[model samples]
Target: MELILLCHAATRAMKTGHFPTGDEPPERDARAQLASLHALPDTRVIASPARVARETAAWIADTFEIVPAFDDIDYGRWRGHSIRETGEREPEHVAAWLADPDARSHGGESVAMLAARVAEGFASIDRLDAGRCIVVTHAIVVKVALAHALRLPLASIYGMNFAPLSSTVLERASPADTWTALNFAPYE
Candidate 1:
């Protein structure tokens, strides 16, 4: 019942800051990133449909499989807006949203919504294994999953650094099936 979550490799889309917003794991140094994660032995993987995720998962070669349920939080209309544009166009709204991701974005999913979806996705994986199963997904999605496990506030997602190519291990022991956040944002 142990689940390992890994954020997708960094992508130019992340740097462009206005191309990918939904569940898409933007393309980046994934081919290289895969090498680091794949080195670990005996890992079961669940991946999102994002291009970058799919590409990265390819290298693992049957190690981690695709589970659409593991896709990222949907950003809705604000999907591809750059941070600068968002801040400039809606300063106060942006600030408040940052303070509380639960606040809905321009026609988009809220933090609570994100948390709910991520939980459902995680629950779907509960039966996949008795040990660790690595999950490859987007940053926001990973954080939401982490938040659900730790019972953390959504506003706190900002302070948490979810850099690309990072790893977090979430464990759910058998019987009781309680999930615990073992470690977060491991820079590896």
Candidate 2:
């Protein structure tokens, strides 16, 4: 079987001299999840190129043997902007984004773009061995992929909470297969 263990995006930029704080995903204990996962024999970690994911992989590199791949949607002009700034400057735009993330922002990627990137990320899974493969990607990427796995409409992605620093195991009988809601967020 093959398992894609999705991880969330950069919850901490540390560039500000402190952890990046926001009303976003959860801030998890990396050490706990790393110590736990009874990962499969052929398990390989694929993480987004983002710093948080990269550093996270570094902590567990020897155990997981990670390879960098996949990235989250680009927020473009909103890249470094915080929620307060965005809300104040672009109320209508923010509302629209909340309503339908699939709608492309002026300079950022739409949900569809993210879905395409995730599709590209999964391209290598089939040719590999049948054991588990853990892919540590962004939160939005996780939602998009899970939505793809569940065959859920892309529009509902923002409504879901794909656990940060968690695993949504996708075990299967064979590589040429698919399923929905295999196992929701399991705590660390």
Candidate 3:
């Protein structure tokens, strides 16, 4: 099975350096940015429940299943705040979160928690008999997926960057086989 994790298009929060609230709509030209993407026949399309993710998926397919496991990490009190602002306001909390995958100092979901959820999401996708699957989700979710597929430490997510509309491909011969990262590229 081949899995394609597609990051959602840019949103106002992304452009302005604010942490996403999971409710922000994609930028006005988001669809235009994804105009080049064409879904292959027999591909199963899935998306996070976030508005941004659903809108991005719509650009690729007329219908897609909403999967809660692919939902963005909860930012809680830090949502809608600029990274710099959050750091300045709660340096200790931010530091803890960056240093520990299980830290939830901001009262939001921890990296470990997100990873678990992403694992569940992938498990369901693996159950599908489709030859290919496209999951439209957030950058963080994409990073988590990559780390999970590669069997890397959760901290590895911090070292990865997945631009909006980018796609990361992973493949496995069967449900019992290990996943392999095939490619990572941004759509032009």
Candidate 4:
């Protein structure tokens, strides 16, 4: 199986460095960038249920399946709040959350929890008969999928970066076996 993980386009939350609250879709420039991608044929498209992801996926394909498991990490009490603001208000919580993948001091999903959710989402996609599957999701979801495919620990999510509309292709060597990332590129 082949997995084409595509990060959704930028939103107002992204620009403001706030925890995404599923408020806005891609900006004009991000729409243009998404339009520049080549057409994908004979592939199944799966998108996160977030508005930003759904809107971005519509630009890439006419039809797609919405998968809630691929939704942005629940920010809970921190939703719509900037990381800087959160840190300033709750320094200890921010520090613990950043330092530990299992921590959920923001009263939201932990990094490990998000990774597990993304893993479940990928597993369902893998069951499909399609040769290739395109997934439009949040940066965190993409990073979690990449870390899972690469067999990296959940903490490694902090080390990776996925720009808006970035693409990361993972090819399975054999059915249900090892997988390798063919290429990881930001939108040009």
lDDT of 2 by residue, 66-159 (tens): 3433666677677656666677788887788767757765468777877876766666666667576777666667788777766788887878
What lDDT score belongs to each candidate, Candidate 1 first?
Answer: 0.70, 0.62, 0.90, 0.84
TM-score to native of every candidate shown: 0.83, 0.79, 0.95, 0.93
Worst 10 residues of 2 by lDDT: 14-23
**Per-residue lDDT over 1-188 for candidate 1, one digit per residue giving the tens place of the 0 to 100 score:** 66777887777768777637544445545465456556345567777878777766666555557777677666666667786887788788777766786687566777777777787886777655546577778888887788777778766677777877788887766735667878776544
Over the full model, what C-alpha lDDT does candidate 4 score relative to the true structure?
Answer: 0.84
- Local accuracy of candidate 4 as per-residue lDDT tens digits, 116-160: 898898778767888778899998889888898889988888888
Worst lDDT 10-window in candidate 3: 29-38
Best by TM-score: 3
Q: TM-score for candidate 2, please give it.
A: 0.79
The 10-residue segment of model 1 with minimum total lDDT is 21-30
154: Cα error in model 4, Å: 1.1
Winner of 3 and 4 under lDDT: 3
Q: Clash totals for all models, in order?
A: 3, 0, 0, 0
Candidate 2, pairs of clashing residues: none
Mark the regions of model 2 whose C-alpha exceeds 4 Å error after superposition: 13-29, 38-40, 63-69
Alpha-carbon lDDT of model 2: 0.62
The TM-score ranking, best first, is 3, 4, 1, 2
